[model samples]
Target: MIRPDGFDAVVVGSGPNGLVAAVTMAEAGRRVLLVEAADRFGGGLRTEELTLPGFRHDVCATVLALAVASPAFRALRLDQPVAGHGPPPVEWAHAPIAAAHPLDKQPAVLVHRDLERTAGELGQDSAAWRATVGAAARAGDPLVDTLLAPLSLPRAPLGAARFGALAALPATVLGRTLFRTERGRAVLAGMAAHSMLDLRSPITSGYGLMLAALAHHVGWPVAVGGSQSVADALVARLVANGGEVVGGWAVRDLQELPPARLVLLDLTPRQVLAVAGDRLPPRYRRRLSRFRYGPGVFKLDWALSGPVPWSDPSVSRAGTVHLGGTLDEIALSEAEVAAGRHPARPYVLLTQPTVADPTRAPASRHVLWAYCHVPNGSGRDMTEAIEAQIERFAPGFRDLVLARHALGPADLEARNANLVGGDIGGGEASLSQFARRPRYSPHPWATPVPGLYICSASTPPGGGAHGMGGWQAARLALRRDRQA
Candidate 1:
């Protein structure tokens, strides 16, 4: 039976952003309803025994670097202890090193939490490495706050300006101009590849700088049990603050929902159009249609008999590994995907969660999570290419796999409807797309229909598991509610 009493606000979808929005609104004394299509609450925060029963794997996002640094998450106090949960709010465990970028002939470049240690390992380019990443790290939370929030006049304008000037250059230009050694260049290239754009594209340097700085600011850590623990923490906080979540309720249309003063959508533009296209103005609909998506990702989960035997033993010390020989190789691979082709030796991002969090796997066993860029919606399987790349770095990597599960573009989209064509970063992170997102407007979150707003990763600070988009939209909704 449908309840006649409508909520003060209804948040569609229960991703990190949606959960944050619901929590924010509920905390403000509003009766909120958080809805999800899946049986689970977390969107990308799911964990499953995909390959084997004993080994647990993160289905999507594994790292919590961005989550910890996000203003929205910080405001919610997710790092603190919750009443019901055994661990503190999102218990995190870090490896000795944050990330390792391995090359063919030289020692792998390791990114340690300590900036000086990371720089010292770069050999000839140590000074240049420190000047760029170390300098950004020194700027610290103020710099992070400026980058994570919506595009606006920053509180620390000088720091923002300095960071912006350097961040605007192409990753290729930054690598070639600033560093001479493959060690430093590979590290920066690995970071930039996270943007899923061509390394030559403008503002690609920003991705590299931001990720590198994050490594120093907060080491890339995983939730104690799995990524789901992060979501569980958020849910615990939300429930404590009076928000309620209804799982397995797939909202097909906005009109079908119970009456509410505000509706926050955690969906991307495509899904939003399907649900509320008729109500939206023609101009807004067109803008949403124009919202471009980037390259897709081909992911893999492996139940390993043992740890990946890296040629460089130090590579095992890090939680995440970037496997592609050098800067030029990674650039070529990324460029191939952007041009709608798959590289034979694709650049791969692999995370061995068990290294830091032992609870993820049974004793003497390990779990490996990895993915590589593929052309959007491409049906071709790149498991062979990906495994081959890992094998290149860790000679007998394939031998350690007791079982493996692969998700191509279609599989990824099927699991999470928001991952349109498997383009994971909400939408393309291009300079034009970054500024305009769905469209160029002062209030990007607001729609033509009153009381409706978009709070997906497609908004400002696009992509990653950060909850800023939902937080920004909810804050806006609250302001409008006060005005009403």
Candidate 2:
């Protein structure tokens, strides 16, 4: 039984963005309703015991670097501890090291919270590392603020210009030109590979630099319990602010729901077309149909008997680990995936939550979350390849796995509709796509359908757990409502 009235604004999804949009509208004194297709509220933020009881695993996103730095999240005070949640605070647990990239013949390259410390570990490329990642790190939150929003004249012009100059180059070119040692290049390359773009692509360095800067700005933190705790906190705040959330309710048609003054859809382009295709103009529909999606991911979760036995001891301290070896190796692996081929040694991004927050698993046991890039809509099982890559850096890793759960591209899509073809970044984060996501309207969130808007990761500041897209869209809706 669906409510037929008394809502000023309606949000179509309940992901971080959707939750943010609903909360924003509710805080603005608007009667808001948040609808979710899934049984759970969080889209990427959901956590589950995929392997065994008590061993919690983040279903999609694990790290909270971007979320911690998000202006929208900060404004909502989500990082603070709520009165009822717990005493330890449902905020975040910063790992000792942000991330560690392990190699076969040398010590692991660790991204420390201290910029100088990280650069000092780079050997011959220390000066260059200081100039690039170190400088961005010093820029801090201002740099993150600029990158996390739509492209505009930055408030910190000097820092933005410095970041832009380096960000303009391809990761491969920048890595080769600046770093003399493989360790330095590998460290940066591992960060860049998160883009899901080829290393040779222009502006790939931007992703690398942004991620590294975030590592220093706010160490990659995880929720106190699991990612679900973050969602629970957001939902609690939303409800506290007078918003309503309805789960297990999919909106196939926009008109099916109660009439509202504004509708903010936390959905991708393809989904928009499905729900409101008849309401949109022919030209707008055409633009959405042509929207591009990037490579997919093959995700795996494990309930381990013991910790991953890494050859490098530092690897155990870090929350996140990049398993691909050298700069060239990661570049080759990313290139292969983009070209629709799974590499024999794929780059694996692994997160050990139990290392930082022990609540995720039982005593002396561990939970491992890892994923590797694959072609869009790929059904191939890369379990063997992924395990082999992990074993390359961490010996006896397989022996520790008590149970494992794997999700291919299709499985990811089945679990969450927003992850089209398993692309967790909403859509492709290519330079061209960044400029015109879905379509090139001046107000990207506002659809041509009068009161409808798209506020998912498909909008500006493309992906991540950051709720900027929803926050921006909610602001737009409020502005439009005032005018109306």
Task: Score residue 480 of candidate 2 by CA lDDT.
Answer: 88
Tens digit of lDDT per residue, candidate 1, span 1-484? 4447998999999888898899899889998888899998889989888998988999999988998888888788877877764446678899888999988877788999999998887889999988888888888878888898857557567877877888999999999999998778888999999999999999999999999999998779898889898888878877777777788898899988888999999999999999997999998999999999999999999999998999999999899999887899999999999999999999999998999998999998999989999999999998999999998889988888999999998998998899988988899999999999778987788888999999999898789888988998999999998999
Q: Give the CA lDDT, 0 to 100, for residue 334 in model 2.
A: 96
Which sections of candidate 1 miss by over 4 Å?
A: 1-3, 84-88
Candidate 1 matches the true fold with a TM-score of 0.98
Q: What is the TM-score of each candidate against the true structure?
A: 0.98, 0.98
True-vs-predicted CA distance for residue 191, candidate 1, Å: 0.6
Instruction: Give lDDT tens digits, candidate 2, residues 131-196.
Output: 988888888777778877755557678888889899988999999998899998898899999999
**Cα RMSD for predicted model 1:** 1.3
lDDT of candidate model 2 versus the reference = 0.89
